[model samples]
Target chain A: MRSGYYKETIVEHINLTDSTLQRAWIGIGLLLVIAAPFHFEFYGLSLITLMMITAIGAMGLNVLTGWTGLISLGQTAFMVLGAYAYAISTESWGWPPLLGFVLAGIVPAIASVIVGVPSLRLTGLYLAITTLASAFIVNHLVLEFDGLTNGSSGIFVNRPVIFGYAFDTDAKFYYLTAGFGILTILACLNLRRSRIGRALIAIRDNDNAARVMGIDLRAYKLYAFVASSFIVGISGALYGIFLSFVTVDGFPFLLAIEALAILIVGGMGSIAGAILGAVFLVGLPEVTSFVFSWMGSSAQSLLSTSAHEIKGLLYGLIIILFLRLQPHGLMGLWQDARRTWTLWPLKY
Target chain B: MNYLAELLASGLAVGAVYGLIAMSFAIIYKSTGLLNFAQGEMGMIIAYVAWSISTSVDGNPFIVALGSIGFAVLFALAVERIVIRPMMSEPILSQIMVTIGLSVIFRSAIILIWDGLPHNMAIASGNQLVDLGGVRVRAAQIAVLVALFAAIAGMWAFFRYSRFGVAMRAVASDDATAQLMGVSSGKVQMAAWAAAAVLSGVAGVLFAIAYELSPSLYALGLKAFPATILGGLDAVIGSAVGGLIIGVTENLVGGYISSGLKEVAGFVIIILILMVRPYGLFGEKRIERL
Candidate 1:
């Protein structure tokens, strides 16, 4: 009898209540955005902005790995390209910084096509290795073309200015990133609703079946790589703006892995997952360190030295646990809870 | 001419070390169909163990080496049971991610314990160099190459003769068929992981003698990946040959072209090779039935 009631509630929720629930969730998000930043001061605000930027990066990865089923470890390389493009255009070529941001996305998209064309034929882990190799090659190339990239010392990025208003302060940059972050989420949602997105999903589920359905495998695969990389590149430009500098050392294999982790933890195929993952991963460490500091001076000192090591350990454990038990990640867990809540008053 | 000879000698030695790790990778991949991304960190951990054992035992290199390999086998078996056994039925991507996670954990654990300091093995080789027709080479380098060849030859003989080895081969060829014939897939996979870890352990100890021990040594695991790919992930003998090919090309490029290209050359070559042969040179062709 409980199972029957549970089934009825699930059926009713899916058939009748999805739109209402979605609107309620959207309202919560709007309220949080308006009220949340005012609660935190400068450092916390900056961290949240950083989370937003990384969320953009994670969402870009989701479009490829989660939605389209292409595993790439080269997101950092694309971001590096975006950063360098922004720096070179704005600082070296004397272009407006705003225009440089646009070029940041465009340039890496072109490079993604070059890298993706040959490697996409190989399946599974083989493609992953190819992308990883491309990242190393690109890293070397960045170092080699020192004349354009200013070599290993890195390039200083000018503060983003919009019609005489400079986003130089943390608060100003917070709004700047928040605006872009919302735009990225909206753009991602729009993309998932588009024909191309459906085709990408079709290709991911079954390539042969998708081909039978007249979806061009090569075109869509390349499109996924290029499109996702473009968003990642834009985030990269924003990353440079946040740091006020771009360097080769800033992007490494670890950064790529971190982005991949964020995608997995956020619930790969959803925009909300990306943002939630960004918050969890980025915020958890900060909270941990704060707790450690409250213990004493010695613990604080130890934390300073081994903070990153601890973070790596945590990230590894989380990946293992989530993959083993909750492969759908935090977003999936949220979905399960929502289902259960909707079925309240029935024990099942 | 002498410069060329010395470069070849050095390159061959490094290649030999890479060959050891590649073979290690091929071992696990053959039976389990999963790439152990943590292969290098496993090696580094074992090397640290070997170093510790050497210091405690008054620097007896042979005993330390043997002890390290023993520890590695045990560690690998434990890891297979705890981490990988649960993931046996998971997607290939999730399995790979688990390995990546394992690598991260191992690396960080090493840093936490060892404090990221570089330690010299100070092994018995003692920087000894020999002159062959006026081209100098380290005695340790010669030992490395000889040991690599001997290990490969021993592996070939074992696979052809040993009962457990043949069972592993059977399982690799067809898991269900082998199971029907009374072979345990779990045991075979455990043995494969143990063997792979042992090989990596030996490679790590040898590597520490040539270079200082540091946490960053795990990067070699990534470097050896190309060798595994170039030869075929499941081809044991191909790994040795692939390792040598990558090793020689890297040296030649670094010697003749800018040294900067050496690191990038392996990847570039692998990409080109993969483009032409999607399954690698010696990889078994996978036929998908849709």
Candidate 2:
């Protein structure tokens, strides 16, 4: 027990030092923000924008799954709520884009609290299934509320205007997404340092133990859901602004599963993991298609239709492999590599 | 009255398919304590296999049905061996994720092999309308009801009389104790998955008669999730009953109210039911050991 406690402190120390490394990451991110638009075209910028939005959503999922020990398949459902809310408030009610965005985040966060309250009593896979049901309900609600959501035709979202400055082009939107992405990262970083964050982790480690220690289970769990869903909701609103369209078809349970996959592949609790996982999972198809097209016309022709299938196969394989061999995900691998590099002279 | 009877008959028919799929879910959950998200996909894929077999045999429905179940058992055993067995010691979350990943793979594979277009499965009765006094029901619907009852009765008898079934129950209750008692937990897990696959396969074939076969048929598998959840994740009888409730609710809502409510009704019931009974109807109340 003494050794176990010592080991945990050592891990904690490593994380503290890791934050210093995160400063360097911030510098790199700023550099990318300044440099990416110049280097890449519209498609590339749009993809990066998408990746950033996904990263924010993945972070939200990480908060629930990684920190609070709650597995939610309803991340995309919250996102859809945010997206549709953004579209409706901005278009139908003639609300300002900024207010619409704020409404989007608040609405889904409240929904999350409602959904989390009753279901939090259940643990593990049961909670996961409940969340899955929530996603289905979200999809159904999108279809059923045809008057508001416009049914299958969906709604068109205009570019978000910030004090008369419009984020019209893909590059401009990429900057907006990047700004939000950085804010999400910093907010999450700050959250982890706060007492509430510590409480969340403690509950994650053992809910009953945390409860014994005088922590309110219901409040903290709802906090986690609200906080996470708030972030996911913002990402969804931005996603709508970026795409300039919203469709019921756009937010399938498949998309939710992919978000969960990002969390798992990124390293559940790590901030950097969310970004890395999102980029890798989102960019994989584009990269695969690029490589395939480069191979020759024949290969591309054969795989044109089946490219999605191949991507699914590879993604599934990666999930299984990561779970079996590297449960810490890509972020874990990065830490391991950093450790090895730091210990190079000593050679183990 | 005639419309009501027709609706009831059709609802029971579809509910039987859901029951079959839900039973598969219950069996796997009972034995392994993990829900197979890929069960529906496996069923759909196996139905396609059945379709191929039927076509090869000049449309012999019996041979196709038998072959499909056989192939499904083999596929399930392979899945258990290759993907599931290695991760036996992992967390429940990891196992669940693996199944979800497996589901994606299976869905994509079906798409790859057969493309995304729907296929017509030759129903044994060929859309024949059977007169049940004043109310007319499709022969395929009757076949589905019969198949559901047969499957349930067969499962009951197997659990009651068969040595393997008894061994499986032992393993499910306590794997370590069952292993000590000389029952191979591995084989039991395999059999449980196989039984689920066979049941799902039969459901898939019957479903194909009612609805077109397509990659999207995995959605039907997802449709069974609420059934298992509502019934009790591990109770076979409860799952069957839960399926009937969901099936009938969907039909009644679709028929009587707005048709758009059909798909959403089951989910609404699930949320409402879970709010009241978290463990679900007929589920064993878990005593948390603090």
Candidate 3:
């Protein structure tokens, strides 16, 4: 029993060290940011932008799944809501682009309330199926609501204009998206430290125990839904505006799964995991495709022919490989590296 | 009146297919605690492969369908061996994600080959029709009903009479106890997957005939999900029965009420059924750990 208490103290000490590691990571991130612009080509800049968008979405889903333990298969639904909200509000309604971006998040937040109210009763796979239905509903609505969504022809989004500045180039969006990425990471960190986050973690680890602790499971679960949907919405708006179009063709249920995979591979329950996840899961494919493009005709043609088909297969393989061999994901791998480096002379 | 019967008949045909899809879901859940999200996609892949083989060499439709069924059995074994085996003790969410990833791979591969075009093709059966009372039922729909009936019988026999089937029942009730009895629970889980794949393959081909073979057919994943929820996730028979009910009610609602609200009706019933009986109509109430 004394040993158990000692173990708990060590665990707490390790958690404190993990926070310090995060600060070190931030230092590394700033250094990378400083070096990146000077060294980046078009593909490099685009890769960073893609990673930022992916990190934002994965972080949003991390709250829902990693923290709240609501296994959703439909974060893409919120994303679709955000994208369309951005497209229609900015391009169609003549609303200010900035406000449209904000609305992108607001719309999904409202929609999550509607969906989550019915859905909060469901646990585990039932909850997943509920969200799956929502994803289908959203997909069908987007396609059929052509009168508003422009049907399957797609919605064209205008470039982001804040005050008078327009972010049209990859480099420009990279900076903006990266800024948003930093803010989002900060928000997620703050949320993690907040009371609501603690309640959520309690519910995730044990719903009944949390309920016994005077934590309202329903309220916290809905909070997860809202928070997840809001972040997914913002990411969607960023994606749509950055691309200057919104299409149902791209935002399928797969996006939700892919985001989850990224979250898992990066670390199911960490901010640094979110970063490593977005970079590895989302950035890996882009880098792979870019490499293919550079290999000239044969490789380019092969990638063009099969790239879409291979992405999911590769992501699945990565997640499964990591889970079986390294369940702690990238963070676990990082820990192993640190331990080895710190113990270099002993060779332990 | 004829039109109404025809629609009812088609609804029954389609609903049976949905029932089969739901049954595939139910069977896997009964044996292993997994909600295999790839079940529908598995069906789609088998259907496409069968269609490809049949149309490619102009092979006898019978031979092609049989080949496809055989392939699906092997496919299930391979999937279980690779994806499901390693993650036996993995979290429920991760197990489900493996299926989700497989679903995407299946959908995209179908597209890469089929190029997203809808295919309207006859199955092993021709365009024969029979008049039942005043209703004209298509031959393919009849085939679907027959396939579903045969599937139900096959499952019943395997579960009730056969030793392996009985062992599967034991495993389904509790894998550890079954393992204690020396009935290799892993083998039972693999067999259950094989059975699900066969059901999915048959349902896929028939449903492909009922609705044209479109790449968008993967979207039908959720069409069976509501049925599974209504029937009870672990109740195999419940899947079939719930599917028929959902099918008839949906078509009737679409016929009587606004068609736009058809999905809403299906979902509402699902909610009601789930709330009223989470174990579903035929499912045994499971004891949850506190």
Candidate 4:
């Protein structure tokens, strides 16, 4: 149990030597992820795929709000930009699928720098409000530019084809999203140990102190915004492909709030928390529907009509309850349980 | 000329509503050092309460408005005690998230209860146009202007003369010093929330009178952000002026530019202002210490 506990050197510490049990658990988890589509039905597979897509976005948000201490209410706007970027480049301009995907991430990164330049000067709630305003502005622009975006009617997106293969089926798309999700997780994990990530954490902790320590506050913040928006934009592109349609309505303001909720509920500043939160929150509606089915026909009917509102209420309640009772979120609870289990025979 | 005059008059009326909401935002920020995102929702829920009262019992505007404002005070007090007070020790980010959570809960609850449909109150002379020379305005617009003036005077007098209000201002400036001076920061915070609720309640009720009460009314609360930002987050009077500026700009944009641009005009102005003056026009420049 303590094999990896004591590290002698900085390299060993940075390398994160996993114990045998930890490695086995990770291997099993990876296996399950790869085998999920084969075991689950179409509906279940699609739901999991959706959760993975949401996890990608949540990870992006965690980079900004959780790690950097910057609050953005315009995450959905970046997602919209990415979705539209991908859709237009691929469908309108006849660009290749791979290049279009890359542009999806790049577009939102550029937009983030545009918004970040003016608004990053202000911190806390002011930054939040600015982000919120940016979301509205982005949505309005999408609606106004009917020629490019097709207005409220929306545009259809073809399933992404790379090289010679097309990811058209739900099962195939699930693997595509999973591959990206794992890459995002690995990227975030690497970022946490990198110099840039340390600078961002420093800025988040105290910008003035960070500046005193010779960290460029503006530059690091812009980097955080760029990294966060870039990942979120990719997630948005995946979301567009998942729906096979791109519309402003798909990227509502509530979705931004949902991303924030994921960070809070899963555990802020924890990479594992992002994935856990995404699955829990994304799967919550389905869980509620199943319970509603057991209740009776009346409950099921209510679920169909007021599901969105009910889900919103639950999300709100969960956020408040978690903040009040479990500030560290589900990840905190998991860690505590693991510690207890690991030290079963010892008091300490 | 008449068309422009009519637009300006309407803009002033709507701006007054924004000012009232902005004042509500400023009060909370001033005293608690926390931004209440749910400020607009508080007014919205109260306005819905007013609508229900007018529909079920009596259509008397006075009774409806007074009852709702009374309810608003209790609601705000409860929220402070239940949600805000417990969160005093948390990080500012957690507190902000709490308010955002509160907003979502309030909005969703409103939808669950009222079913997301817009409701019209039978109290105000809603559509009746009162002509002032070359300009014509709705009676509700006149009521809105009256309410804004009344609110501003009431806030001024309270801050000037009232003991609690003075304590709130003290706490806003410096809490530890005020605490040493025997003014309970908790009570001041509670009072701030309650005072903000009153301002928002009046604004919401007036808004319902001029327009209609709906779940989306919370968006109007969001619009007040630009006002608060423009006026400076901590300046009550500044927010009011900012509200007027945003209202007129939005109106002119709608009248001249595409109607779509009207909704985002205030936001665009706020971005411009933040670029030039992060502290806002009338806001006190805050000096931070390491």
Candidate 5:
């Protein structure tokens, strides 16, 4: 076997010993994701697509809450705004579908700035409550502007026709969402290494110290908010397209909580953790149903009827348990497992 | 004029319930420095327990109330010990998230046990209208107001004169200093949670009597945030006054403006207040050091 420290160059030393192996794993994962539709049924395929969409939003949330240390309970509000923006622009304003998607992001980003500017001064729990209030206000506005949002009855949306190619089929839509999701992941990875990203992390760790170090707290916080909401808005657009209908009820307060759960369960401040969390949480209900199907009919019936509550309870328990036991989350667990495997037959 | 008078009378009663819940929130924030997101859910669960007790005890209000308060204290103590105590050393974010987790669990558990239907409680003076100077009010409303005053008075006396209460205040200001002076911050935090639970339990039962007990009752808990924020996160009496303000404002807005605006009136007020005074009307300004 080759010795671990065989590298002569500084660049080689900086890179992981298993960098090529890691790249190969990533390649295989991508291939599997691309081939998922062929291997799985329609239901399973749709679930995977939904997971990718959720990952996009969760990643956006990670940028704010994870990286910047800002707590937002209004993420759903931005998603709602994005969904409505896409729906209204394409349906009423007669904008092109692609352009509507762009607007979807822009609208919520603007709203985020409006909300962020006033509330970014407040930190921690105070900021959290402010975001929540904004969410209520957004929901109320969506309902009040019946002329634009079509009121509580909701608005119908058609699949996008990009460059004369229609994304009509579920499989076709899966590819569209997957493309965006991969792009989001790449962007987040780059961001974590970028100067702005470092500044954000510093601010999160200690804002006063960051301020002393010449970081513009207000501008960077706004940038974090804008970047976060923009991606979430795009995801919202995808979610609206996936459902082909958008309603106020579609984005509930629970959605925000679920996003927070995704971050905590995955691993805060880790991009890959966001995706893992999305997969685990999105697939959770299906897993529960499969298990419940094996139980007695009466028990299964009871569970099915109260499935929403059961899911909520599980999410709550998971958040609490993860924080109490494994604060670093599934990513930390994965790292420990990998270390164990790499050190097989050695006590170390 | 008559309609306005009726609205004001009912608003004050509803405000009293809000005040009680706000007090509960303030109590925890004052002593522990942790905003309890599960405050409303605590009230909701206690109310449900009280309802069950009422049904089993042949609708005796006194027994139901006492049992509910006892249950609330034990439940709060258990929560403090189990969910919160372990998290005491964790970051503020973790503490907040834990309470949110507790909220989700409590809300879901309530739904799982009680179902989603609204239940009418026969514990309080049920729907008996009392005409006061041409203004019609429910007897339950009057009882809620009385409870609110009694609670505020009791809290004032306890905080002002009691030894333990002074210890809690001492811990709140400086936990380290309090520890040096022989006050156990841990015990004080536990007492704060228990006190909050009792206040929430009473408020929940009173609210259920005034309105009706339902799964949606927990939403009222969220509304109390505005009250607490308005009065000041750590101001007990200020939060009570804030609740009254929020309650009356909500009524006037609902009565005069579109009913939709009523739901968000408190939020709007708090937002404006935050812009002007981040600490709140009655809250002390906290100066941070680098």
Candidate 6:
């Protein structure tokens, strides 16, 4: 039943073998991506690293807000769970970093099961309240739990050591973070092809009809919530490993809003869009806004204090303007451009 | 026992300010289904204007008070006409984003102007203290309660039988039908925003009168969000009532439990309330059809 539906819906848009002309475009994209790492070196490496982390988080959000149509503001909270979970489990408990990272995802997945089971029944804005409250809860918890998290004072993280080799530099970490980012994107893309993904789409578009079609909404919804939480958690872990510090302020309502911005700017319900949104929305602004505004500010204040607030404000405005002009987001615009340019030489 | 009385006294004073902010929140939501995320920030900007106006007006404290309220109202109206009105018809998410952007802009602008300084104003400078059973309460706190009541009563009277309020109701129900019924919803929407601005005016006055005004005062928007959640998103009465509930509960928690837990406790209550009564205490639920 679903394969037929997929054929009807997606196959009509792109037939792989019929892409004789489009294949050149595909090759060009691959050439750029492959050449990107060597030409830009660490700049390309770190940018892709940041983009990967953001994309992972956006993918989690895409499932919740994009696919399931559940509004959430707890994206950063889940990320914090992964971050703090890794920080404590590895640094304090002496677990290896890899095991600690896996635990990070598990921690938030467990939390979503606890938080989602009750909160999912409410529709629209009311459910939004629950997520908002959860964000506040996480922020406070991270601050108040001085015993584990060091409270608002924050806990510092050390670089990860893999098999006696410490990944100290950004380049070393970029390889690891980018690798995880790619794996996450592939997993998310594959998941979108599965029955679980369709059920989520059905639930997002219409819950009652999905239920009528024998979609176990309660199960699928919970699964999407947990899966998204897990991915966000992993992103959080990467952030801690990336920056080597975790504070109550590390995860904020702004992260969730930025994620919302990315989703809106990237177009919902597409994996490629998540990557596009994350890179264009988060990475682009992170690089340009930081570099352009660096004029005379001290490097300490640049990365540490002032830059955070300035970058956040810029991201917020960019998301709003992008959404206003590109309602379907940048991805939607890209597809439109391709279609319009197809017969430019002659009016077909 | 004295602790309870003292808590109530301070709680009422603080609750009045939250109530005022929530009132503006409710008015905007009731008229237009937008949450106006910038409402709290608007209150902060208005409070700053009040501070500036009071200083520029005169040395006489009463005139300063009036000037503060006046400037706040004008600022709110300007904000409505400029930033908010353009966003009144977009998607809820878009409206929210615009408001968030406006909030960032407003806060940054205030920082540029004010340089993050806290203002000290004696809005209640008579040195009059009312003694109730050995408890000497500041005259200003009592005045706050009275002002809130008077404002609520004025709102009640205006909305109860006023022509504009009735038309606003018609617009709220169905904009097209209201327009056909000779009610210009655009004007109504604009008026609704104006009324919300006025409420923000009253709130900024109450806030400035009681507490110090600073750039961070914008954080109250997130704080008042709980009041909207607890009282019901679109309930004007609930906004007032929600204000008091949050104020009292927050103070009580701060006083008895721990001051550090104040913000967290409020949100925790919101989560529990949403889990049980998701539409809020008095919020109306409308099922959406795609």
TM-score on alpha carbons, each prediction: 0.95, 0.95, 0.89, 0.97, 0.96, 0.88
- The predicted structure with the larger lDDT, 1 or 6, is 1
For candidate 2, the docking band is: medium
| Better by TM-score, candidate 5 or 2 | 5
User: For candidate 2, what's the TM-score of chain A, rounded to 2 decimals?
Assistant: 0.92
Q: What is the C-alpha RMSD of each candidate to the true structure, in Å?
A: 3.0, 3.0, 3.8, 1.7, 2.2, 4.2
For DockQ, candidate 2 versus 6, the one ahead is 2
User: How many clashing residue pairs appear in each of the predictions shown?
Assistant: 0, 0, 1, 0, 0, 0
Tens-place lDDT digits, model 6, residues B1-290: 88888888888776777777788888887787777777877777777776776667654667765665666556766767766677666656566666766777677667655756787755546235678886767766776777678768877887889999888777777877888889877677777776776676666656666666777788777777788778887778777788788888988999898887887777888888776776678777652322
> On a 0 to 100 scale, what is the lDDT of residue B238 in model 3?
81
Tens-place lDDT per residue, model 2, B1-290, is 87777777778888888888999999998888888888898888998888788778977877877788789989999999999988878877888899999998888888877778888877467457788988777677777778888887988888889999899788877889999999998888999889999999988887887767788888878888878878988788788888887888788888999887788777777777777776679776661222
Candidate 4, B1-290: lDDT as tens digits = 98899889989999999999999999999898899999999999988888888887668777776788889999999999999999988987899899999999998899888878877766857657788997978788888888888888888888889998899889989999999999999988888899899889888888887877788898879889999889998989899888888898899999999899999998888788877877788888881212
lDDT of 3 by residue, A90-164 (tens): 888999888997899899999999888877777877777778777767776787688999988888887787888
Which candidate ranks first by lDDT, i.e. highest? 5
- Where does the lowest 10-residue lDDT sum fall in candidate 5 chain A? A10-19
Clashes of 1: 0
Query: Over the true interface residues, superposed, what is the Cα RMSD of model 3?
Result: 3.3
Model 6, residue A181: what's the lDDT?
A: 72
Number of clashing residue pairs, candidate 3: 1
Global fold similarity of model 5 (TM-score):
0.96
- Candidate 5 deviant stretches above 4 angstroms: A1-18, A341-348, B287-290
| CAPRI level of candidate 1 | medium
In the order shown, the candidates' DockQ scores are 0.61, 0.62, 0.40, 0.61, 0.62, 0.44
Which has the higher TM-score value, candidate number 2 or candidate number 4?
A: 4
How high is the CA lDDT of each candidate model?
0.85, 0.84, 0.81, 0.89, 0.90, 0.76
Query: For residues B1-290, could you state the per-residue lDDT of candidate 3 as single tens digits?
Result: 87778778877887888889889999999998888888888999988888888787574777877799889999999999987888879877777777776777777778766767888767545446778898977777888888888878888888889999899789888788889999998888889899899888888887777667887777556678778878888889888888887787888878887676676566666656655666678878872322
